[model samples]
Target: MNDAFGKRVRRLRLDRDWSQQELSLRSGISTPHISSIERGKRFPSLEYAKRIADALGVALVALCDDASELRSPKMRGSAEELPLYLQNFVLNEEATPYLEVAHQMSQLPKEDADLLSLVIGLLVKRRYETPVLTP
Candidate 1:
């Protein structure tokens, strides 16, 4: 985590033409602390991470390469090529159906599991329309 985060921060800072002292001053994180963090010797708390990210104009999670949010099943390349909704759907497909069905199914009783099932069935059908062939 430290190695990846430090490298990311260093890369971003250099990209912005900012030195460690300048970044520290802008982020309100002391120069010594910034040096420590950039050297992979220390980890910042959530608040500090946010401050640094804001200063660098990057997402807070960019400073952390941990698997839960940033690093898991990673995707690459520019976002301009694809739509944001499609990118998010492709990245989080595993959890989408479960969450959607759970929320919608909560109002129904045991017999209505089929309610969510029917919705999904229709979605699948609509997505792949096949023409009828008559002989």
Candidate 2:
């Protein structure tokens, strides 16, 4: 991986106040591997990258700026709407936790995407007809 991505990994790890060993345990990756990734000594495969992202409580896209378009086509509208709603919605104590899950909606499968979209639509208290899906 490039040094910039390594820096991003290190920053995210540090943001959670987690040591490399801690990250390794959560990620199911070895501490040495985690160290290598953080130091830009290795380029991890997508699987490893995904482990790192999930452990960081961030979506895979968060780790890969260039991969923003990697999302599944199912529920594209909801995936696109998440950022807008998050940007404009007023803050409340209860809404904080859901924000993280919403960020992860990009990776959800079609069935889960439908469920989450319903929940998010309700959470936003918006009035909109649901989109029909074609297999």
Kindly list the per-residue Cα lDDT of model 2 for residues 1-135, writing each as its tens digit.
466566677877776667898889888999998898888898779999999887776666667775443322232222345677654552556776676666567466669989978887796664455555679
lDDT of 1 by residue, 35-54 (tens): 88888898888888888876
TM-score (C-alpha, index-matched) for candidate 2: 0.52
In candidate 2 the C-alpha lDDT for residue 131 amounts to 58
Q: Any runs in candidate 1 off by more than 4 Å, and if so which?
A: 66-135
In angstroms, what RMSD does candidate 2 have relative to the true structure? 11.8
Question: What is the lDDT of every predicted structure here?
Answer: 0.69, 0.70
Model 1 C-alpha lDDT versus the unseen true structure: 0.69
Highest TM-score scorer: 2
**TM-score attained by model 1:** 0.47
